[model samples]
Target: MPILKDFRYHAPVGVDEALALLHKSKKPLLLGGGTFVLNTLKKTAAYPTDVIGLRKIASLHGIRDAAKEVTIGSMTTLAEVASSPVVGEHFASLAGAAACVATTPLRHMATIGGNVASRFFWVDLPSVLMALGAKVAWAGDKAKKTLSVEDFLSLTGPEARGIVTEVLLPKSGLTGVYFRHTQTMEVDLPLVAMAFAARRQAGGVKDVRCIVNTTLSRPVRLTGVASYFETKKVTEWKADEAADVLRRDLEQGKLDDYRLHCLCADLESLIDKFKKA
Candidate 1:
């Protein structure tokens, strides 16, 4: 590992300038907090030459609220998101996910954009967002477009020409439960992460979603697990029954046999916790 060769640096003052830089460069990497980039540069063979720092851009680092939804600027720090009163109150699952990310110092320096944009499959936010049915607002060449988190995580799609501007989450009547299984209580990557959100209609489960995050290529949705509870009484929740159904519903080879077994049990535990909580 060695220092990266001297390359041009662009610290755009605002979003327009940032977009211009992106449009002009053939290959430009957006630099938010630079936590992962800097580390990789030092320890790995992956390092980009042209770095476009978004830290100075004020417009890309705030939160906004409207009558129907909440918009979170892409460059906002994870720490800021964790402490956002609006986020904590309305999107408790998201806030909790942000708070549990890395650590106090890392969270303070890790931007939401970089965290979400990383290629790592175990990153927590995307799964939670997908489960929440959140949408990401992207600005590009032809025109701005928005994609649901699930779509954004798709394996093949149109390459986003510009950048992710903000994340929009609809205001809904739902409660969220997030569970991460780690090797220890200290800072460590999650072995398995589960997020569940349910909307109660007349005191019964009306809508439910579950997302499982791992080190694989992409997050996995336990559609079988979710479908089992739909239109059923929440009071009759049974972990063992759901696990049996999930074993038969999900793809047979998505995970290794050992991991598949563990994750199934984790999902069951998550459902039990949600029921108790």
Candidate 2:
């Protein structure tokens, strides 16, 4: 571990108080569960003069299940997410993704907000969130707004001057499945991943969303692969044909053969799941 430089840390009890502190502090960094920021602070020279910790904020910590969607507070930890029966019942892909993060203790310390806000391309949540068609409720200097996970990730430095308040997951009667691959143990950083989701329509499935996290850049949506699966019945889906289209979908991604092989194998497993479903 690198040496963590000296910095003044403030714990605010509410979002408004935290935002006020943010407005006044120069080069301030917001701390969520501290799994990412604390690690980052040890290595980065662009240190914050003030570290505003959001842990004390009560409003930022619960899972609310509504009739239309599930609202997860930004400060909700991965362990909380993984254990929430509502999350597991409604958003199985996200629940599975959360459960697969780091280890038990680390999961307890890592917030969903930190996971999404870090935008560390290689991390696990973004692709699964995108596959689930999730959105973030953001509070910023200018105004409050809701943006899709894809749009939220696309924001640049200046444009990202805000905090994510909540992650909104709509209930769409969709079945979601996630598959992750790592070079070594299951706890290792994933080399690649795939998130598959779709709604069962009459005689077939529709709204197919196939997402691949390359762990290189932004996660790619496998539109070609999704299109191929969209029109076909679950029984008609074949692994070899799906693999061929997946290769075309990933033509520009320039992934190494190993990553591609893992993804193909996962795709075959996904097809098997569909058949079983």
| TM-score for all models, in order of appearance | 0.90, 0.97
Once fitted onto the true fold, the runs of candidate 1 whose alpha carbons sit more than 4 angstroms away are 43-47, 155-158, 184-187, 256-258, 273-277
Residue pairs clashing, model 1:
none
* Residue 148 miss distance in model 1 (angstroms): 0.7
* Total clashes for model 2: 0
Residue 168's lDDT within candidate 2 is 96
- Which RMSD does model 2 reach against the true structure? 1.2
Error of 1 at 37 (Å): 1.3
Q: Write model 1 residue lDDT over 1-277, tens digit each, in one string.
A: 3656665799999888888887787667788888888777665544555679998888788999899888999989999999999989888999999998888899999988887777578787888887777898877665678988766655243365567788888888677777776667774777677777878666467568877786575777778878887856666777778777766755643666656666677767766665675
Weakest lDDT window of 10 consecutive positions for candidate 1 = 152-161
Writing each residue's lDDT as its tens digit, candidate 2 over 1-91 gives: 5787788899989888888898899988999999877776877989899999999899899999999999999999999999999999999
On a 0 to 100 scale, what is the lDDT of residue 26 in model 2? 90
Q: Please list the residue runs of candidate 2 whose C-alpha ends up more than 4 Å from where it truly belongs after superposition.
A: none
Residue 190 in model 1: lDDT: 71
lDDT of 1: 0.77
